[model samples]
Target: MKIELSGDTFYPVGALENFLPQIGRVVELGDLPIAVFRTSDGRIFAALNQNPHPKGGPLAEGIVSGHYLYDPLYDWKIDLTTGLVQAPDTGRVTMFPVKVEEGQVFIAAAVLQQA
Candidate 1:
């Protein structure tokens, strides 16, 4: 379900603690599935759960290293910050804006619409 909060129209997914550093969590925004992550440096990111590779895989289940998410299904390294597939591959993953307010995590509804 989609909930609007402000012009930013962020939908509450969960609390900051819902995500662990170097881990990714799968969350839904409307009908769109997203991979929400928290890096080891206390940074948060959200992206489409599906990998762009022809033989797709679940990105949320991938390994997180720094700002890169290594797709375990095929070992494709993806840049979490930009959603761009790193060297040797030529593809990109869609990314969404994330916000932490009042200890809660929210994703922009606008991004959900785009997805």
Candidate 2:
């Protein structure tokens, strides 16, 4: 979680509902491939998510369960809260900061771009 001040950086603000609940997808904010999703409560988050290994499947394509998602690529279950790969504690994804505004989703652009 490295955050630094930059003048060229921009944050995104949008409605959480626009993202749709119970569904997940990979979004590219500038240059980052973020796995964006809304919890059962409609809260959204953006993270540096990807499936480990070249299984020809995306981690974002898995079914999100609570804070984890079942990676369809190799049937591996991942915990989103920690971004840790289950069955082994050595794997994790880089998660970014996300904030919600008045009916919108806000994200740190420079960070996403770097991811």
Candidate 3:
């Protein structure tokens, strides 16, 4: 789920050690479910845990490779940075801003409303 918090400051959800490289971790921000990722190359990204496909797959369980996540449910490739579904699929997931401060990971709680 996506949630919108009224704050400009990023909220710290967990430490860097809490994230597994090349794996996605689900973090709850209020009522929102966010998928946090730590790439093998040391890049961090945050996206909505809900898959945009009709199956309603959990994106956090998807396989992480480079900047893309391969959804295990439907084998759909999703861009971690943009949350855009790679070719063959035509949908986009919500991408959140992630910040690493002093070894702690923080995600912007702002969520854009879809039309």
Candidate 4:
């Protein structure tokens, strides 16, 4: 399903309950690969599936702790909410706005245009 808000389009990825807590799953947004994560506390987040490190890795395979994702390849800490690599690391992943409604998960299309 698709929802339009203020000219931004939100595309539904899946049901919120389908996502396991602390586990990341890759979903395709057009041609873009997005890493969708549900935190232990039930918060949902979405970001580009590619890690920001020079030696790239799959973000979906990374470990999620709280709101941070530890890169599977280099163990770099990345904030799932802001996409910022924590201090001592330098790089940023592209994050997409996520919304949960009626048990459904949606990701914004605006961020995809910027990516």
Candidate 5:
């Protein structure tokens, strides 16, 4: 399911039902690795697979609690929606827009612009 909107292309990553709640999956857009997460409430979020922390942990391996992801290496709390490293922690991960249509998951090509 590919969608073209105003010159931006949305590439289908996988089926929505395949994204388990509180789990993160890695999808590659060209050379970029994106971490896609699904909350318990069925909301989808996408972010760069790399954590913002100096150690640069793999966000896909992080623990998801609600909309926040706790970095598996540093335990840094990051908001999945905004990619903000919650309080006390500083730095942010790049985030991409995600859309689910008819049970298919799509991630926008805007990430290429960011790259």
Candidate 6:
């Protein structure tokens, strides 16, 4: 599982840590905006929070599937782990590396260099 550190800042992308127990939330890492999802199965994904094909508000933009979200606007699946734009969409979004320290989540700025 990918452990994405996100709360209000960006961090480095050094592989990843373990997953956490969460219901998912929005995180701000530097200039990179992201959404962190902690699956019920303990799987974590950090996908680019932007919806190239947005359906509406941040809460109503895409469909969650495992560690990826299916962009509702273009029928594409975005990988939160690598921020990889999969089929239905060609362009990829930004993905930042994250980790949780203590009880708060942290983002690595190095991972957002390309974002």
Clashes of 4: 0
Candidate 3 C-alpha lDDT tens digits along 1-115 = 4444345568899999999999999999767788999999988998878999987978999999999999999899998888899998878888788889899999887544444
Q: lDDT at 29 for candidate 2?
A: 67
Position 55, candidate 2: lDDT: 46
Please write out the lDDT profile of model 5 over residues 7-110, one tens digit for every residue.
Answer: 45788999998899999999997777889999988999988788777777689988889889988788899988788899898988887778999999998874
Alpha-carbon local distance difference test for all models: 0.84, 0.63, 0.86, 0.85, 0.83, 0.55
1 against 2, candidate with superior lDDT: 1
Error of 1 at 9 (Å): 1.7
Ranking by lDDT: 3, 4, 1, 5, 2, 6
Model 1 alpha-carbon drift over 4 Å, by segment? 1-7, 111-115
Worst 10 residues of 3 by lDDT: 1-10
Which candidate number has the best lDDT? 3
Least accurate stretch of 10 residues (summed lDDT) in model 1? 1-10
lDDT of 3 at 12: 94
Instruction: Output the worst ten-in-a-row residue range by lDDT, candidate 6.
Output: 12-21
TM-score of 5: 0.88
Judged by lDDT against the true structure, how good is candidate 6?
0.55
3 against 4, candidate with superior lDDT: 3
Best of the two (1, 3) by TM-score: 3
| TM-scores, all models, native as reference | 0.88, 0.73, 0.89, 0.89, 0.88, 0.57
- Clashes per prediction? 0, 4, 0, 0, 0, 11
**Candidate achieving higher TM-score, 4 or 6:** 4
